[model samples]
Target chain A: MLTRRLSLFATLALSLLLVSGAQAADIVRLATTTSTYNSGLLDYLLPKFEEDHPYQIQVIPVGTGKALRLGRDGDVDLVLTHAPAAEKAFVDADYGVEPHGVMYNDFVIVGPSGDPAAIDGGEDATNAFATLADEGATFISRGDDSGTDKKEKHLWEEADVTPDFKGFRAAGQGMGEVLKMASELQGYTLTDRGTWLAMKDKLDLEIMVEGDTALFNPYQVILVNPQRYDGLNTQGAQALAEWLISDEGQDLIDAFRLKGKALFHASAGEKIDPTSAVHESD
Target chain B: MHELMNTAREALHLLLSFDPALWEIIGVSFRVSLTAILVALPPALLIALLLARVAFPGRWFAISLVNTFMAVPTVVVGLVLFMLLSRSGPLGELRLLFTQRAMIIGQILLAMPVLTAMLHSTLQSIDQRAWETARQLGAGWWQSLWVLIREARFGVIAAVLAAFGRIIAEVGSAVMIGGNIEHFTRTITTAIALETLKGEFAQGLALGLVLLLLALVLNVLLGVMRGRGHQTVSI
Candidate 1:
């Protein structure tokens, strides 16, 4: 009886696997950034894609570093992420092909509403950063090897003062998470505008300083190098990439708004000034 | 401080409230680990019996190899499994990565050797007279197998329980192979890692408390089993 019951269970499991295999062609695997996942972009994008296509897309969103790692491992069919240098390295390594610009956003400094650092003035990003260092105000860093974390580290490097003030907390988390930590601690933090705008309703923090050309963050979508991983779903990935670069997709990106505010601008084509005003404004 | 206290109180409320996700996680943990043990147990017991009762060449070397696997960490198990299951890996065509089956495979690899080593000791400790008496009483080799199995049932059960405890609580194997995808492979430990990263302390604390309770409850169950075993032995 025990052996019979066990075999029955095994048979059921085998049938399930068979069913999954029959639908393998009806699936596309995507690896993307935690920002894209946590920011609710994939949640919004997937339903539309599923409605349009018979196949379901399974998104595996990790940190930018991990997303690239997944692509390098050929664990996913496509990747959507930021981190220009890392993306370049991936493409150069022949792990990804045909990388395209997806959207544009910027990083900003947010702090307690009380302005404990008195960080607001017609001050440049470096001076504002120096002010925070001088006041010894707590600042939370998203030490999670993410695109945002990379940007924060770069900005601190540019400030040239090695602003390692008291409470230099590296939380090693996502943008939404690090922002919440900042809110709870009422400490200062660097955040992407998209995640901040999405979460601003829940936060009492104010944008202390932004307008920095050096803080512009861009997102890109890349199809995995099919030659590298023979099992990659190249046709489906290309189809998705074409849709993203198409007029309808670009408009959808431009149309994605949060709390009566636009979060990102389409960066598919058209080369206008990229944060040149930020330097002049400062 | 008040916020922290409020959050802790809320966490307790959610835990006692029997949230659906909590139970789903517990069920998944039990089902996966249970399936893993059930799969590993037969082969493990067979090997243990063969190693203990059968005389064969290089049997000691085989036993040593199994013992060596007993010390292999879950992370290494996960890495090796990831390669075996990934798209570019040797078994890439299988596409088992991020699936529950892959998790079970990891768990089986995780639990089997430990189970074998444990049951080997259990069988070696069994009185040789029990099997000999069963055979003398007109029992065949198969019947004597059952007789010996019954005699060492306590230690066997303990072996299974310990293996279950190990896999159910393991994080590295679960995350790497299962991917800890939400509403999918997110076991208790991986979920705790994510929640703690999000600084969602109430949820994190609630999950941690549940994991703690599970450990405590399993320990109590083991103690009771031992107590009951001692009583059965005396009887």
Candidate 2:
């Protein structure tokens, strides 16, 4: 009886795998950042993409560095990440095709309600960071070389602060986990606004600083160069790329919201200026 | 075959270099899994003894429940823990999520069922006369319980070893609860997953080889313990 039951379970599991396996053959592998994956954006976007597109998307969420590395290695057919400089470098090196701007979001500095560093009401992210460094305020960095991490590093450089203070921590993980750590420790962190909005209710941390032009973050989708790697799914990559910048995809991205506030602004056809000013007057 | 050779060469280099990053990952894996097993050991043993010796009403059901848990996928355990430890969950106030403590808790949950179920069968296999004889000799409850455990010492050791094997290499719960923070919660398995996703197969393969070596060492220890158990029983 035990053997029979075990076999029955095995058969069920195998059959399920087989069903999914049939669909897996038509899968289009896309390497993306954890921010896009964790904000529940991909979960909302992929189903719509699948309904119209011929290929199924298998989204692998990692750091921006890793995502670009995957593209360079031809491990994935396409890449969707927010690190514009790295994306540009990858395309410039001919590892990937030209990256199309998909959407734009801004980063926010979130911390405890008391706002220990007095960075609140500041439009200058660099100045706020410099003050945090000088005060030795407990700041948690994503530290994973993610797009958010890159922005934080850039802000530190712009602020001319070393960020080597004793209170600074590098939680080398995704954006959501860093948010949780910031809430638990009451430390400050830089995060993409979409993820911040999605998880704000559950966390005690509040947006302490915002509306900085330096905080602007944008996302891009690039097709991995098929010429570099054999067995490359160029057709699937092309189709997905074309569909993303299409009217339908832009509409879907524009329609996505959290807590009645739109998380991202679609910028499919336009060149995104990284230093574009965010709405501070609101 | 060429890829395999290259991976083996890389694995050897990583192992020989005494790489701090790799060692740190190993340290996290050992620290979490060892602490989990130690926390789980006493309770699992006591429960196994109870289910083996006591004439409880729901004893059969209890045994069946334990056996059922043995089949629970690691990912399901991870998902359950993730929800419970997330900022929105009931335990959110504790703020234990994304910490080594949370991963330890998940590993404890995972190890308990395997330890209890395996040790239960070992306890059952011990002769009932061994307990009777201890009692006949005026042995106290604690003394007799110790003797009974000694009788199944090899089996208990094997059970502990098996539990360790199940958890040390588990990725799902570790990644889910621990968040795989580098220099913090990243274990060998989580690191391997990350490296493989990044298309760095050499590092992933090296980590895989280390896991395989760990399993081999554990099996060797189990074999030695079993031999000693046989000698003691014969004498």
Number of the predicted model whose lDDT against the real structure is largest: 2
User: Candidate 2, residues B1-235: lDDT per residue as tens digits?
Assistant: 6766887898778878977777888999999999999999999999999999999899999999999998999999988987887667788789787779999999999999999998998898888999999999999999999999998999899889989999999999987778676777889998887546444667677788899999999999888977876676677
Every model: iRMSD = 14.5, 3.5
Who wins the TM-score comparison? 2
Itemize residue pairs with steric clashes in candidate 1: none
Error of 2 at B65 (Å): 3.2
| TM-score for each predicted model, relative to the true structure | 0.52, 0.77
Q: Candidate 1 residues A1-282, lDDT tens each?
A: 999999999999999999888588667888887766766767876787678766678898677776887788788999988777778778878999998888877778999999988988543676777888778887877765677776776677667657457757665456775676577557898887878888888886999888776767778788889988687788888878778778878888788776677767789874433234322111
| List of clashing residue pairs for candidate 2 | none
lDDT per residue (tens digit) for residues A162-191 in model 2 = 878866877666788788778866889999
The segments of candidate 2 whose C-alpha lies over 4 angstroms from its true place after superposition are: A1-31, A34-62, A99-103, A116-118, A131-140, A159-173, A184-186, A230-282, B1-11, B75-95, B132-140, B194-201, B223-235
C-alpha RMSD by candidate, in order: 20.6, 8.6
lDDT for model 2, please: 0.84
